[model samples]
Target: MLNGGPASDDHERLLLAIEAAGLDLWENDLVAGKATLPATRTFRELGYSREEVGDTLAFWLEIIHPDDRPAIENALVAYRDGRSDNYRAEFRLRARSGEWVWYANYGKVMSGSVETGLNRFIGVTFNINERKHREEELARINRLLSAQNQQLDQMNAHLEMLSGTDPLTGLFNRRAMNECLHRLTRSAECEAGVLFVDLDDFKKTNDIYGHDIGDILLCQVAQRLQSCISADDMIARFGGDEFVVLIHGRGEGGVRTILEAACERILNILGQPYVIGDLLLNACGSIGVACFPTHGTTVESLTKRADIALYRAKRQGRSLYRFFDSGMELDLYNRDSLEKALRAALKTRQLELRFQLQVDRNLRPIGAEALLRWHHPVRGLIGAMEFLPDAVASGLVHDIDNLVLENACATLGKWQHDPELRGLSLSVNITARAFDSPSIAPAILALLAKFGVPPEKLCLEITEQLETRSFVTANTAITHLREQGVRIALDDCGTGFSSLESLKSLSFDQVKIDGVFIRDINTNTVSQAIVAGLIGICRAMGLQVLAECVETPDQMEYLLEAGVDGFQGYLFGMPLPCAVLEAGVRDAPQSQRG
Candidate 1:
């Protein structure tokens, strides 16, 4: 071990310290191409005995892992040529157990300079197997996390697609359609033709065959529409029996003809018969057409114009299409003017309630139904049917309904003192918008208290449409009123989609049969059977039955024989103002009182 000279005390101390730290010292002779390795505890632990120490540089290179050999050789050459001051590399070496052990090797020139053609490297090798294993495990974990993140990204995309798509028809929904319209309007180069399609008499189909079949029919309609359009066209379901399509990239010259051809193709396709299960159903559609920069440029304007055109199509007879024209714009202007005037009427308190008597079979007054009337300055007396649609569309019907309720309560309070009218109750029709208000019950109760009228003397009328469409809100309002001793009556009962179901589940004090069946009951056998069946059902359910629109003596006799509990029609006297009604009641004889 001691070849050239005796080691000084400082050198011997350094060697003892290095051995104590479990390190093996290595020396490389660049000129001789030989290496000297100390027989330290680390070398022994690596299964290299004293005989294995002082190996040549070739023997050290042979022990290095094949993958790391080139790196180690290059690092040594660079250091010898003075390109680098030191050499460092981590590599695996074969051990006595035939296993690969990781080691960190670091070295620097020791005694001679590369310029002098004489050089020696002094370095240490240390075991680093535990740290290497930890690094590999962390790498594996990162790979796994990366894979999971990719899968999550894919799932999020799928969920987004589902949210924007209709489950039943596999088409874009209203929200997605609105977004698409917004995008199309923003692009200056994009020209689109919009078609608003509504199924003709869809409600009749639903009423006759039920909603399950109706759903199947809608699905079939969607398939037919899809088959009629190209891949670049967009189709969306805008809720219940209504669909919209956007035909992209409009052609130049003959654009109207192109749109007309497309519309005709759609009409022809949708007019085909659909066979669902064992039932063969015939249906048709009404389409309204609008084009970008022609009928409208914005989504709202386009959709509104399309709706106006659709109305014209339906008005001209079903199974047809109509392009938007300027005449429809006048209709819109008129509707807007009407809505503004109605709002002004509400603020100025120009609305009045007329009371129509509900009489017993003996034609004696027992109650009165409040009908809304608007006395416009220029339009003369406007019936409820003339202005109520505009009012409802403008979201002003709730205010109108509240005004009627307050008036009815005040009328009842005044009639409580009149001996002839004291026993008569007053019924007021509630609009669907008013009934859906969460504050409706509290507002009505407050009115009754303010007028000092008993709740039993007030009746609230709700349509079958309201009861079926908004079951929860209607039921809550009904239950709250009933608990306050107010009577609840289902008005126009046999005209909605789910009348029988609503009657079975909802608590109603009376069922006012629709005027359609009552007006024909005297001659139509089917009307008689339906009226009789309704009467029997009401009797079995302990509900009072009233027939509306009774005009003739024969109609009156038929309803009376059918066990109707009450009659409300022109025959019992038309709707009269409150003051006129009070005067008439005061002039009536006590023998006519029910």
Candidate 2:
């Protein structure tokens, strides 16, 4: 215990204290490469004898565990060289039980030898396996926590995607579009265009085919709209049957040009026929465009203007696009006022029907076309074609068609006793929207029965637009109505998107050659030829050909020679009130006037 003397009483007490604390102490001689091990209870704890494990540092280094050997060696070297006040290291050691036990070694210079300076060191080895095991458990728990946090982050990202995406179309929803628009408007020198596209007559598709097909159509339209813009642009399903496109145009006039091109592409692409299952669907879109900084700076203002322009597009005629103009705001106000007035007209019975005489080639009155006229108290009289499109957009055309049917039945009933008018067929114009309603046929049948008028005397004129929009519904309505002895006429034939294909698919009793051809029939050889071809086709198909807008005597003479079965237009008679027509039906080729 002492360097130069035998163990003193105090030294013996300290050695007893160190042994009592279960500290295994040892000493190393660097000069001779020898080590001494104290006779501590480690010999028993390791289940080894002093003779089995010799007092050699090489043996301890061999069993100290390969990972901890370097650090333990470094600590001993530092203390021996006086580079550190003390040397300590924690490491693992293989016990006699073939398991690793954690231990800490601490050392200090016991003395310098005469042969070499600082040649000796002494240290204590203590078990630290329990503490190390606790640390390892804490580390494992931290790793688990870190993995959970990463999973939580990924889940949050997925939730955000679902919230922003449309469930059916997979495009961004309105919330996402609004956020994007806000960011777009705030961008520096923001140059962009917003196109608000609403599908024309989409509700008819839903009503006729069911909502499932309608959803598929919406998705198909979304794909088409996506094709119309570049990757820099965004197309989102803004609402039901409506999509919003945000295009980034980089320059001054470039925005307007890009917007126009995009809108045109949208109309053309979306207007393409969709073949779903066995059904071939024709869907079209009306686009309203507003350019950033030109229309307005804010997102709300720009979207509002775009919407206003969209209203104009649908009203002017769907399947087209309109750019927002300052004049549109006034037009919108006027349209709103007109919508109110039209509704009031329906309620107050200001809506009335006039009769345009449809006669045979011999100038004998054969039938009358029921023309819709609004006898506004202030604006005098307005024709149906002038305000009917706007009325359709305002959701009032269906009501108007119903009223027309009712009035036509009433007028036909009044003509029952007159010898001249009793034989007349009453042609009533039905709107495309009315064909979408399932009640149209039943209502017509009911009205005819109620008024004691024969269904054979009622001719329903349906435009080619109706045939092209949804031939399924048109054919269904036409078949059902025709089967009940109600005659169906293809109105304005060869003047719309419908082709000869429409003629082959739809069944009709009559085909009215559009007025456009008749307008120039006297001098325009091309018009004359088209009218002749149409008449020949109708004759071949067993459909009676009626020439509309026959204004001049030459036109009427030409149509009669061309084998036109019936004639209508200003030449025979202008549209007159049904009351005046009921007064005496004398508007004939004999008089050339109403």
Which residue pairs in model 1 clash with each other?
A: none
Each prediction's TM-score against the native? 0.57, 0.67
lDDT tens per residue, model 1, 1-594: 454445666688898898788677887777788765442555576787766755666656666789998888788788777788788888988887878888888888778765676567788888889999999999899999999999999999998898789888999998889899988888887767889999986876786578999999999999999988898888999999999998875666555777788899999999999999999987889999988868888999999899889977876777999999999889878988998889899888789988888888777788899999998998788789888767766778878888989999999998888777889999888875576666899999999999889999998887425534356667888899999999999888777557887787688999999999988897899888888888889999999999999888888998898899899999877889888877776667777785
Q: Name the TM-score of candidate 1.
A: 0.57
- The candidate maximizing TM-score is 2
> What local lDDT score does residue 256 receive in model 2, on the 0 to 100 scale?
84
The Cα RMSD in angstroms, rounded to one decimal, for candidate 2 relative to the true structure is: 7.2
How many pairs collide in each candidate, listed in order? 0, 0
Cα shift from native, residue 547, model 1 (Å)? 18
